[model samples]
Target: MKFTRTANANWKGTGMDGAGTISTQSTTLNKAQLSFKTRFADGVGTNPEELIAAAHSGCFTMQLSFLLSEQGFTPEDLNTEAQVTFEDGTITKIHLKLEASVPGISEQDFQDTATKAKEVCPVSKLLKAAEITLSAVLL
Candidate 1:
């Protein structure tokens, strides 16, 4: 099986004074903003780090759900947050926080499954260069 996704950016001007709009094939993120302020400063725009965080969080959650199913439990809800740390113009680390509710599963089992998900999720593998930390709580 093969899957491909595409996004394009059109930037104008230069450096900190420049800004760009990004659009994806599906238009789910149509004309998202990217700029120096969005990247380095706290600005109301989308940046690469934010996109990576979102992708990681979504991927990890789905992986955990599959893991939970394989462990004979069904997850009721799973909430995840990925904190991508950028410093010195480099991605330093990604901290993942996951809170899950799985019926009929022990806390230890849920935690073990979540840890496994961290190791095997596609996005996690892709971002292996960065330090990946997981905090899982079973509710």
Candidate 2:
């Protein structure tokens, strides 16, 4: 399946002082505000790193759910959080923390499956330049 998704950003003024709005094709983030302060400081609105984290977490969780279904294990819940560590103008690491509830799955099997999902998820593959790590808990 090959497809394309797009998001647009409009900025005005200098990098540090400029403000921008981002709009996605899906309109999920229609005219969402973003700015240098939002990205580098605690200012309100969204930023690229936060968006990347959201994408990674969503992708990984969905992939893990598919893998679990394939392995004959139905999950009660799968909560994943992706932390993108951006330092010195680069994304140094992405850490995935997963809390899952699956019936009758071994710890080792769960860990292995999560590892596989993390390695194969589309966002993970695209962000391979960053060090990716996972801490999965089977609750």
Candidate 3:
């Protein structure tokens, strides 16, 4: 099966003065880019890397949750943070940190499942250039 999303951006002016609109039609990201500072502090449209981080984090967490459930463990909570590092003018690494509380699951089991999830998740598979690293903590 294949899935896809469409987004468009329109920019004007220079780096400091330019602004853009990021839209996904009528979806959540429609016309959503008035400012795009690194952390949205300078009033610029959101950048691609930031959007990639958001997608990776959400996708990885859901994949981990599903994997845990399939293993007959109930996950109390799953927290994930994805750091996208850029070097030499391009994205170089994706660091993933996942913390999950799965009742009735051993640390080893949890870690194993997390490893598989990271390998098999759609976003993880899509990112070939960036190095993907993961840290899974069980509680």
Candidate 4:
């Protein structure tokens, strides 16, 4: 399956002083504000790193669910948190913390499956330049 999704950003003024609003095609983030303060400091609004984290976490969780179903295991819950560390104008690391509840699955199996999902997920592949770490807990 081949498809495309898009999001638009509009910025005004300089990079440090300018502010922008991002709008996705789905309208999930219609005119969401972003600026230097929001990205670097603790300003209110969404930033690129936060958006990456959200995408990574969502993709990984969905991949895990699909893998579990393929392995004849049903997942009750799969919670994943992706932390993207941006330093020196580069993304240095991405850590994925996953807490999952799957029926009829061993700890080792779950770990292996999650690792596979992390390695194969679309966002994970796109961000492969960074060091990606995973901590999976079968709960």
How high is the lDDT of residue 82 in model 3?
93
Candidate 3: C-alpha RMSD after superposition: 2.3
Off by over 4 Å in 4: none
Candidate 1: segments with Cα more than 4 A from true spot: none
Residue 96 displacement (Å), model 3: 0.8
Model 1 weakest 10-residue run by lDDT? 65-74
TM-score of each: 0.96, 0.98, 0.86, 0.98
- Select the stronger candidate by TM-score from 1 and 2: 2
| Each prediction's number of clashing residue pairs | 0, 0, 5, 0
Q: Is candidate 2 or candidate 4 better by lDDT?
A: 2
The C-alpha stretches of model 2 lying farther than 4 A from their native spots are none
Q: What value of lDDT does candidate 1 attain over all alpha carbons?
A: 0.92
Q: Which pairs clash inside model 1?
A: none
User: In order, what lDDT does every prediction score?
Assistant: 0.92, 0.97, 0.83, 0.94
lDDT of 3: 0.83
TM-score of 4: 0.98
What lDDT tens digits, residue by residue, belong to model 1 across residues 1-139?
8999899988999978999988899999899988999998888789999999999999999998888887788899999999999998899999999988888888778878999999999999999999999998888
Cα displacement (angstroms), candidate 2, residue 108, comes to 0.9
Clashing pairs in 2: none
Between candidates 1 and 4, the lDDT winner: 4
Clashes of 3: 5
